[model samples]
Target: MNTAAVVADFRTYPLISALGSVQTLADRVAVEWADGRISPFHHVWLRDNCPCQQCVYSVTREQVFEIVDAPDDLQPTAAHIDAEGCLCLDWHDGHRSRFDPGWLRAHAYDDQSRAERLAGQPQSHLWRSDLQLPVFEYTALMEDPAALLQWLIAVRDIGLTQVRGVPTAPGSLKLIAQRISFIRESNFGVLFNVQSKADADSNAYTAFNLPLHTDLPTRELQPGLQFLHCLVNDAEGGESIFVDGFAIADALRSEDPASFQALCEIPVEFRNKDRHSDYRCLAPIIALDALGRVAEIRMANFLRGAFDTSVEQMPRLYRAYRRFMAMTREPRFRLMQRLNPGELWCFDNRRTLHARNAFDPATGARHFQGCYVDRDELLSRILVLQR
Candidate 1:
């Protein structure tokens, strides 16, 4: 059946109370909780998500039922609430399933429940320049799960942290990165060298001053976490600069709501073309998650393509862009530091704008090994360590 017909048939089930009354309609069932919340579950979904050993593997906890094999008009032959407040179902196909009421309530797709879940998501702790950067020792991070968890939490909450005393040897950055998760390979390979190189593919390979911006905004899925390990820094003038993009965006919202709104509304194009790859994407400079919280800040003047908006909107977009750029450079938001050899600086690429000052590449050598990791993996590692 078509999607609309399926949805229509699914909702035909009457709402039933878990404690007071039980009701079942064609191919569906509804459960009303003690808290007066009612939710309908389609028989197909219930059968697919069945927790029985026959439907789901007991050890691996993975679904074993094949949805395509089930009958399209399948309905529950018998439905009732068990003593433990579980919805027990006997299907027309001679199958039995029981679903916990709490699980059903939590997994409900109703508007109110979805909104509540989004609102309950974890939010970042925006930081300003005055905040001290969280630092952890390499040994502690490698040996103690507690220390590693603390570092991951700091990166998630504050967008940046440092691990000192990392091995300065070549390719050691990959080892440190793997401690959290697998490296995300880009056009620059699994681990790219950050040094002044002749005929460089990107500006990052030069000694020129790089502006505060997120990396690879041209790609649809930008890297989440970035690790830059300072293996050599004998150069004179290459001070690393960082700014909390979310913090700056928040400040802009307070100081100039119009500009903030413009930034959040207008979509800007970011493009990167080279001999090997040509990448492009269109996204707002300030992106918000479903709950209206800052999720990502995609800005890179070097990679930004020509404006494609109308004449009327161009002026407003430029004003907003200029205002946001100025805020990123404000003294109160900028943090400057010279990373020492054996120090690994990791930051949330989505929320942090990193820059580099012009260095005298001719005078002395400066080098760093860099890699990318997804934010989900970092959070997963944190959760596992906590457990």
Candidate 2:
């Protein structure tokens, strides 16, 4: 095949003016961009990512190229910036590939590019009681994509949101969850009733002053999102409480760095063993992402198992644990509300610690149906709506 003819054809395209100088490296092609940035595309990567109909299925947009069959010593024999501003390459294995420079720049893996990508991720807004929680009406959420998108974005960023005027009936919780994605079934069914029960296996089923905690921390993969629909909340007290675990962690980090580090370094055991199921997991109380940002908080004092750390580390762990618990209960970090009937509360289980004030069940009935959904589904729905 004549390589000159391919370059001449690309030159006729409208985007050719954006093309810059190109050089062939030992095993890749370095294309300089009009913005004074250079992006290096490996020969094998270029070949595997070829946008040609023969390499990629036109209908499915799936790759047809076999990575294993690609030559191990593949390198660009001839490379240049085509008239279409694409990095045109002629490989030693007689294979050709053309990559859009814009695409390459957008996907560059350099340090600056990676940092920018991370910065572009959805940011969380820390809040206290003063911050008015974003609320969406159930009817609007069901009928309008914009309303649903707004609620989903708030839940993703703030880790909490409320929906009012939901139908107060059984299975309504699951119906609303279905609007986001499939319900994440666990030891608790897809939809579990949250009323006081005799001989309750969990503290949540009782009418006691439950301390602030994340649910099901004993599980290795804890649920990311939680939905609590207040079907009937007429009892005295039992006000719902929420604390931004991430915000508290950040506060701890600022106030006492040593305690925060200890919480992040020590792995505490959480176990839930009953006649029906035995679940246990070990994880740090404060979890950080690759960038050292607070990402998750797993704390359940009720379900915490025996402290299995060194004697010397025990005191430090206890100090850190107490510090974290104290911060969670602080009024400056807590948001308390009495969820009325026909209201549904949704929050990020991984980042928000929830609790309930003691209520007298004998006074009136207080029922709430609850369920879980993975965070990916919530974010996925938001992305689809944005598109």
Candidate 3:
């Protein structure tokens, strides 16, 4: 066959033959054997993108991760090829990982095929109040346990619930948290003996006056639900206030649509710092789930920090934040309650926003033990209950 004909045939039937020994697996992609034979053995495993800590380490300050020290051209070593054709890599910091050949090839092909699904799925209901706070008719929840369950369901749905009959005592809140599985550990445990003084001191662990907000926004993975069982009720001005952020957000969307758009689009910075560590996160103030349903409302002035944005963006963000704060403070948007002991009030941290009025420092002491369970866990339990 002439050169042109041979070349044409090779192009049409491109095949690898055992007759030619394999050299370096060139760039570590798939390898084909004779005539339409493909081997799963090809892989470019340990690319520099692995997230293990050895590949990245903090500098002397321990606050920032440095890929390498200065004065050294410590470029990350290329991934090593193993006998099995897996890509093996040991990062400069001594973290190691192996990439599966087949998985690498599969991932390469998958990039175009798989798009991010979305943040959430379709739900039966979206929780909201006319203003910011859910309107709870005491008659609805106080009358009976079954009615209370309905309110609990609402709280479960919206991420906030109200209780009417909690007796005043430190243990009262604990009892309420116990009625349902009070989520324990991490930023949430049974928080009790928490004094108003803690708030005065600005201590997050044991504080009062938890401003109009959601809890734990600075966490990369935030806890889902917060249950605060109010054990004491004698204090004046210390009414339990609840706000439906979703409701307020929806209203904003309907009213001054520009303001609502600004709130939804801009990123708000939340930060928490103490002597030991500091955490900061930048997230949109109005968070929505898949299907465009309102999910969580996160607006905490105390937790917010200075952000990196243009001067023009700042005014709109500041305006939206102020407007939302104003609506949250509105009495109409608030559902007030004096939770007695035996009432375990749960709120979806992702959806509902909650705040409390300053309690009289002398009206006995206001103590509430609280905990968090993931919203997923709560919903799973609900599903089991439905089943």
Candidate 4:
């Protein structure tokens, strides 16, 4: 086997440990690494992940072969560690597959290997009022890739970041947002104005006390990163307030387990309707990922619909709902700051709840432009920058 010729996916997997020995089993092959870690690679799993030209498209690097095409009882005829440290296998059906040691070790299903991979994943850093806000300069982020990566990482982990020294011009937010990726346009347009409007379709457009809530809870897929660039903010009493939704959720989980369970299990409807467009979403206010970690916090009191849960569970729902809302209002979790001109806030809309206090429009004018970028684009940009 030629080690140099072994091709994995587009991702480069560094060799962590050398392949020690190979043992063929009835249902799977047991592989022992030089690090003394034994991993079981099932027959179907290995066959499905073949990196050969016939199995995977070279250009796109996507799997072209389907596992269903292989025999249900397919088994490896011979398995051995080649001289080049590659796992060479011969199938009973005349199909051959070669696995690279680096890639194999990286994808090993052993307990220790799985745990290592999980620990390598990026983790969220929860914060409260005392958080030392992650602030970046607009010139640095716009000019240097390193600076942009740092700011994006802060948004990913801390869920809140502020950028100063931005251009105090209308539509300037688009240029900064495009640095991440294309803007996620909504019914409110690509860059929506955040000034008070008389005939405002949503409460966000009016000078009202908007509660701490995630944006666009009515959408099936809420926006990931939100950029609110303040062009002018001379109005009085319009202080921007933020609360770490993840922190509040943690407190709820600890102080009130039943409420947390109710909120996590119960599904509620959120809606936003106007004369032109109508959008509604029925989902749990709190969403957990596969690991049961709080993946998303979707809440918009103004846009919430009536509770239609079972009558028996209505009280539980209200108790959980009110407790969560109260936590958002807690001073300990609130971070109140006034954003001035040429400064913008980039935060995780699904993790950090934001609010605005009602301002007297007669005193002065406040104008802001905001846009959204999806989580897919954010992660892609981060990976590209890392590479």
Candidate 5:
């Protein structure tokens, strides 16, 4: 729709409590407040000042910026109301930003009121590691297309799923992920792949075995689910092992509160640098939910940088780290699977800690295609389906 229509639609809402009705003419618009107040101007002119960036930037450079101070030269010309009760405006500068009446009514009182991100889903429900992730009969998701979508949603919500009977190929994982939601375009695939390079970090993207750990611990925004499609499983010793890292953390908190408290207090840095890229993040070994529940345990020996611990803290940190490892090795928390050819293993990277059982490279090579989709997309799809 054009700017006029957008603005007209916006003005229908009761923006300011004192404003009642609005009228729009070609060159100007007028507003009637509850207390009989009116401001006449070209609605289009007024819309040019919409807080949204669509009014200010070119299509190629459409980024929103802070609207702290309105430029003096910018002035409203015309105004109108639309079906959505929004205040539409015309600006002398020819740019338009519709003042969404609903938005104004809700937020205009305080200039500093923060817009909070919608409350995120329950972390446990969004990152389940032990609840028997849905396994699909390879032919089902393909033959019953609707069911395939549902499976993808469930996987997205929990951050993983497993499938059997699909042929393992270089592109097979992509095909499955396409079914999951067109492969999220940005930050789209496996974090690491094993390769023949003596230095793994030097070639992190190539096929390689990974230890039990969460991906992107160092990243400010980590990718959600991980897909590993096994094309060839002839190599020995590369059985996939997953541990419920949250469960391990929870147990640690319950059995040894001091260790848990210590971990929460200490900040560990994770870093990965290569010839082309360098990435680093600092977070505690244990992450807790808003309600104080253990949310995630980001422990990766490969990615861990220096602990930066003082002599007094080293002994406690070491003790806690050792205890965590001991709990992780316990059988009850682990689910082991040798993803053979034609098998796909997926998991919530945020909650499940995965490891490789040291495969023999001499026998044959193990090849897998991997990808990822964000957890938010997955959960949204599920809720949509439910509704």
Candidate 6:
């Protein structure tokens, strides 16, 4: 326990348990934790992950050594639990490698260990019409790192949140949105005005009852985070609507598995055309990650192009599409509220379907500014703050 431990990345891995023993096997190292969990680390895996200054650059914290440069049979000569509870390996080529026990446990590849890690990860809190919305103040988020982290976590898990006490000024949203990362610019521009206009390029700019749908599915990658800041809200009828897209997908899967698969398997086109630019993308209505989990839901009815699937599958696709649309309108899932001046919404664009009831321009002036921030930046900021 007299030695020091070094990590490879710009993150901290807390020591979960002490390393009980290290046994050198024929091709790998067997590590036993104090809790009696065993994890096997191959010789190549250990050598390739060396965190020393020679193997990893100190400033960038990136790997400098490549595993391919080592011999094919690069087995360690000896392996033991160091006094510091780290796994120290002595390779046949006189190379030394040490692994932090915490990092090792966090990355253990055993089935049991992997399952434990997966269970410990954050999960979405599926909500419905009665959801007690997560709310934060704009001043606290900009001033306190702890507040910022909490707000971001809510956005990640709940997929919908609101911020009040914001300045009712044009472009005030840019200051708060930048607290996460850069504003994702589209053909519409960095900050798109959400007001009724005579010549509106999109339904979003008109005073119409927009249906519940995700935004900007016409692009190859939909925007991750969306920010809608209200600067003026004198309108009478434009109430906000929100539905948890993931919750609907889950219910659909349970109620009608066949329809769920249809949406996930069929690919459709979404296009956005204006005098300035034309954007098109072909993707499934429901996108699944490698693990087959619902990673994203892309649906923009206004921008959806004519279905071009084979005649045989056309009826099936339409049935699934109609069923999904029906689920979105179900009363059990919708959340309705009217945002006032100095309030803004920050939600996951990929998981939360948002809409607005038609407002009368003759009633009063209504102005709101909206912007987007990619998911990568939001996750990165969370990690840095966690560190």
Give candidate 5's root-mean-square deviation (CA, Å): 8.4
Candidate 2 lDDT over residue span 1-387, tens digit each: 222222212222223225578888777767666767666767777777776666776566667889788888877788887665567778777877776654555566667657777888999898886769888899998888888888899999999999999999798777778889999998978898888989788889999989999999999888999999998987999999999999999899999999999999999999987779999999999999998999899999999998889999999999999999998988999899999999989999999999999999999999999999998899888877875
lDDT of 4 at 128: 89
| TM-score for each of the candidates | 0.81, 0.90, 0.57, 0.96, 0.62, 0.98
State the lDDT of candidate 6 residue by residue for 1-387, as single tens digits.
Answer: 222338877777878789999888888888889999988988888888888888998888889999998889898887888777778888888889888888888888989989998898779899999999999999999999999999999999999999999998788999999999999999989999999998999998999999998999999999999999999989889999999999999999999999999999999999999989999999999998887778899998999999999999999999999999999999999999999999999999999999999999999999999999998899999988997
lDDT tens readout by residue for model 1, 6-99: 1211112222334434579775677667667767777788888877778766566667789898888888889988766667889888988876
lDDT of 5 by residue, 271-363 (tens): 866666778988888887786776666777788897888999998988887888787777777777788888887777777788877666678
Clash counts for the predictions, in order: 0, 1, 14, 0, 42, 1
| Highest TM-score scorer | 6
lDDT of every model, 2 decimals:
0.85, 0.84, 0.56, 0.92, 0.64, 0.92
Candidate 4 lDDT tens digits, 52-135: 888988887788899999999999999998878899999999999999998888888888989999999999999989999999
Model 5 vs. true fold: TM: 0.62
Model 5 lDDT vs. the true structure? 0.64
As for candidate 2, its clashing pairs are 16-83
Q: In candidate 1, which residue pairs clash? A: none
